[model samples]
Target: MKGCAFNVIIQLRELFNVEGQTVKIDDTVSAEELSALGGYEQYASDMRLLGKIANRAGVVTLSYAVSVTLRHLCDRCSEEFEREYGYELTHTLVTSLEDDGGEYEEDYILCPENALDLTELALSDLRLSLPTKILCREDCKGLCPECGKNLNEGGCDCGK
Candidate 1:
């Protein structure tokens, strides 16, 4: 079976003995791959990932900012529009069970194989940052229920 495209692995061999070392990350993730992550309706062709990863002993710290254009439906007016969003994410990676008290933690990734996969980690952060409701404008008049006409565009013939 093939692995997910977003599952980019990072080898830990070079960081074992290193401490306080930071690795800069600059990469682009396709919207197709991001859509597979399954939280939003539509995404731009590509999203930019920029940030750093710091290694200290067996523990690693991952911090990065993601920027992308999102296509959303306005809840009030029912119009489709595009919006730009940028946010930062941080995660802790541990290489051993003892590092996380012999159990899984939501905020930390367990990398027992001496490698870390960033696909799910990044997706979770992005979804959490998304707003529950998206609007094209603050004062959207919505659609006239009786006439089924967009009120924001113009008034409907329906009384009241």
Candidate 2:
């Protein structure tokens, strides 16, 4: 893969060499380029991935936690706010998949040529974990439909 701030390639050859071995990973993924993803204009900080890859009883697995602070506009009130999000992700690792016609494809992560781009995997997982509708708080009152006033602040003169 082309070298970049978020590209974290892990060599699986060494990990597979010894059974019951674990590899720790702690890295940051740059968020500047992710602004084009839509919804949010920027991130408060880079995404952090902390976890380990282990070969347990011949089954290789990757487990990690990703955390990041995002700057977003609350969908309800249209107020700008910063929120921290955390996601715990786990996946089974495999060097190759049996030809089952892609039946169980999504069950495992394929590390082609014994190389896995962890940052890419983590980013994908993070995106999937995000909420479809983002709100500053759980019980956001939202804005007044008639007056275009933020209800979270106070009620507007426009009744109903």
Candidate 3:
């Protein structure tokens, strides 16, 4: 398969040694790529991933933190705001070249090309890690329904 510039590809041959080793990954990937891999709302230009990947017993595990500054329109106010989010994610990877009609686990990843793509894994974790509702602030007054005014900024003519 063709690899993109931002796709995190790790060669399967790297896990040859029995002793586990740590691989550090730190990079910025575009929101479009992430959204495609996982059903995540892509409001940020790029997402940052920084953490470690370890391989043990032919299984690869990733433990990392993902950070993104998303440009979101407040759900209540409809006002634009930048929200920063940090998510810590961990996942176990499966490298399967062929399907032997065996039962597969939920987190089983089929890496037929011998190059594991971690971009999808990271995006999946991000999707699950994100909050259901994204708010600018806890005490946000939101917009006045009647006059469509930002109540957080100031009072509106539509008296409560």
Best by TM-score: 2
lDDT scores in order: 0.75, 0.80, 0.69
Name the regions of candidate 3 deviating beyond 4 angstroms: 1-3, 16-21, 30-46, 96-112
Give the TM-scores of the predictions, in the order they appear: 0.79, 0.83, 0.71
Total residue pair clashes for candidate 1:
0
Over the full model, what C-alpha lDDT does candidate 1 score relative to the true structure? 0.75
**TM-score of model 2 vs. true structure:** 0.83
**Cα lDDT of model 1 by residue, 9-68, tens digit:** 677655544887777778787888777767645986577888777887657888888888
Residue-wise C-alpha lDDT for candidate 3, range 4-63, written one tens digit per residue: 665877765575344396688887787776555544365576888898778876567767
5-77: candidate 2 lDDT, tens digit per residue: 4477799997866798999989877676444344334678888889999999778889989888888899899
The CA-based lDDT of model 3 is what?
Answer: 0.69
Q: Candidate 2 — which residues are off by over 4 angstroms?
A: 1-5, 33-41, 99-107
TM-score for predicted model 1 compared with the true structure? 0.79
